[model samples]
Target: MERTLSVLAAYIQPSPYGAEGVSLNHGLHFTGGEPFLNVDLLLKGIELARKFGIPSLFVETNAFWCRDDDDTRSTMRQLKDAGLQGMLVSVNPFILETVPFERTFRAIQIGSEIFDQKLMVYQTDYFMQFSRLGITDRLPLQEYVSRVGLEEATSRIELLPIGRTAYTLGEWYQHYPATTFFRGTCRAELQRNYHNHWDNYGNILPGFCAGIALGNVLEQPRIYEEGLDLEVYPILRILLDTGVRGLCAYAQKRFGYQEREAGYISQCHLCLDIRTHIVRQAQEFRELRPVEFYTQLGRDVPADQD
Candidate 1:
């Protein structure tokens, strides 16, 4: 992965992300095999990011998985003490359906107390309510990506894993998958078109994976298009272009070595309260580029120990 990251860094010109010379206005998020699962590494990465002066560190994690993550929890607390901001928790009603609510909520409670608006809960989708998306009849990939930002539209994204990864609550192991992320591939971030996106690790892809939308993040050179858009709508376009400036690829791998299909690659579902025609464009949105963050208790959070 490190080699791949280095390769990616060398691929783009002027550089798209990181503390490098090109750009630094935007921030980066780190999430994976349960961040707390590797507290030391997580903390190390946080520390390095802090050194880079990253404004925020968004850590999306399953709080239930952290119930026993005392060391990592303590490390996270220390990062908070060191001024690292934002900790987004993936909490849904179905959480208790598999793990003990009390256990997961406990870590969340601690995390909530430590983080501020930085703390958020995923109460929709496979996390809780909501069902499958309309595959038979749906918007074009680009158009759909533009729509996932609405508060009302949140419930409509019935995401299953990308290629073959099934998204059923019954499967406790898989959280979010890479295939799910491939949905956003054609955005010029991954491939130019579904055809070009073929091949993975070393294998040649056959065709579009089920519910899979292939291609890179942006298809062709997007500079001219971005420049023109920026001139017309400065505020929104600035964010759209700048928010993801220094970032590498944003992928969510739910399966193990097999690379299963995941859900919610961009975390656009994280924040969509604001309004805009391109509200869920994700390329540049608060949920995707939160400038400020605070995490507090949910409505009926339990009191801490005496």
Candidate 2:
């Protein structure tokens, strides 16, 4: 890990989007609505990786305002000083009202104090979700007063690029593994699958998934026996043994991270809170997690501000 961070840091600050976000290591992605909002927290994560020598850090963000902010500028400077590398910028316009061009242009114009700007990946799902595809399209949001809605729309735009590590990668991306285990469509089936896993739900559980977990009870009807559990440790060993690493709580003594069940942001609740949770994880983290055990991540993240 130290070797990876050392070499990568020599080049420039990490950009966890585009080529940067797509990891050959753990391929894990941390996503968020406004990851850069917590600049101090993020820098800490970068510093830790640099200290421990984790290769290629990816942070996803929907808000470009951070890179555009002075504090973030200093944060980047600090990361450079601290010797961290690998950043992925998610260029999804809907979430980040600004575009990558604006940031790049500013960085170039702003001079040397600025960090490097590299485009790794672009996403399209946010637009699809906002368009007629998501609950917002068919629900109350669509019914919002047009004049007011138009005002809101006119102000928010997805024009900036940001880190893929904006949100916690592991917990957010576990849908794949969870779904692979729970194949059926019914709530009971999903419940049964999750039930077999030895973990119970938490109060401050990620809001995005909780709503879905609760919703699944009504939407799908299924359950796994109470005696079983997901092979988190065994499965993790395979992933680690195979060289996978990302930003989440698979193994950590100092930081509190748990591999909980996943629920779609559409179905679960605490969206913004989840972002906060990961920020805290990156903040109060006391233990060190190997970078090779991370898995599951993508260009998908909110492009606009949180």
User: What ranges in model 1 sit over 4 Å off?
Assistant: 1-26, 68-75, 92-98, 124-306
Model 2 scores worst on lDDT over the 10 consecutive residues at 197-206
* Highest-scoring model, TM-score: 1
Summarize candidate 1's per-residue lDDT along 127-154 as a digit string, tens digits.
Answer: 3322243222213433433444433433
Alpha-carbon lDDT of model 1:
0.37
- Which ranges of candidate 2 are over 4 A from the true structure? 1-30, 66-74, 96-119, 124-306
Q: Which lDDT tens digits does candidate 2 get at residues 120-198? A: 3344343332333222212232243242354443345442111232233323222332123222222332233211111
Output the number of the lDDT-best candidate: 1
Please provide TM-scores, in order, for all candidate models, with all chains considered together. 0.38, 0.33
